[model samples]
Target: MPRILAIDYGLKRTGIAVTDEMQIIASGLTTIPSETAITFLKDYFAKEKVERVLIGEPKQMDYTPSESAKLIEAFVEKFKNNFPDLPFERVDERFTSKMAFQTMIDSGLKKKQRQNKALIDEISATIMLQDYLSRKNF
Candidate 1:
């Protein structure tokens, strides 16, 4: 089976993750500017087949849509229109950023590395993909 790709999209940067061929493990790919993600993904898909997309869905503590929800919604809309054949699943992105930061600190990331919020976003994307993979799939 081909890999499943996950994306944590932000205004300034987007983090991409991918599952192994067996779809058992998820790993962070790279953090890239949002404007370039579409082109990158297009080229990637042209080279490699992707099964589905898992995106971080921004939500508030109470499970309500957060302010970032609007941007994500727009992105989703564009995604749907651009890639109608591909399916998308959403994983609530609550404290994934916080957890990412914690992971980085614990992993011994330098102060300068920690300062790059894109690193946090990449880790967050990994977390989202891992969490989704832990669940039972139909």
Candidate 2:
């Protein structure tokens, strides 16, 4: 069994999450600058067995590409070039960030704590991974 990695790609920062070998749960890994994400993933892959990489695909209400889709496309192309053997799957991530923020508020996070968008991004990655896992099980 290998881990499944998920990415919540953003223009500034990218959030990362990973599932255990069994893929029963997803946990936030970290948030890093988009420029640094590929380097980090390369190092991570060297030490861990990753079965698949899940990339969040943002969509508007009309089911069209969001503004950030272009950046994501470039990022994916770069990833495929760098890690040609790795496989990727796209998951919708329209409101995962908002959901993560709400979860933080519900958990009684202070205003200062809630202001950490990086954390929210990581949570969003977790949400994406969770959704992927749930859909696979069904």
CA lDDT of every candidate: 0.88, 0.96
- C-alpha displacement of 128 in model 2, angstroms? 0.2
62-112: candidate 2 lDDT, tens digit per residue: 989999999999999999999999999988999999999998999999999
Clashes of 2: 0
Candidate 1 whole-model C-alpha lDDT, 0 to 1: 0.88
Tell me each candidate's TM-score: 0.94, 0.98
Candidate 1's residue-wise lDDT over 1-102, tens digit each? 988888999998999988888989989988999878778888888988898999889988899998888888888888888889988898888899999999
- Top lDDT: which candidate number? 2
Residue 38 of candidate 1: its Cα lDDT?
Answer: 76
Candidate that scores best on TM-score: 2
The Cα error of candidate 2 at residue 52, in Å, is 0.5
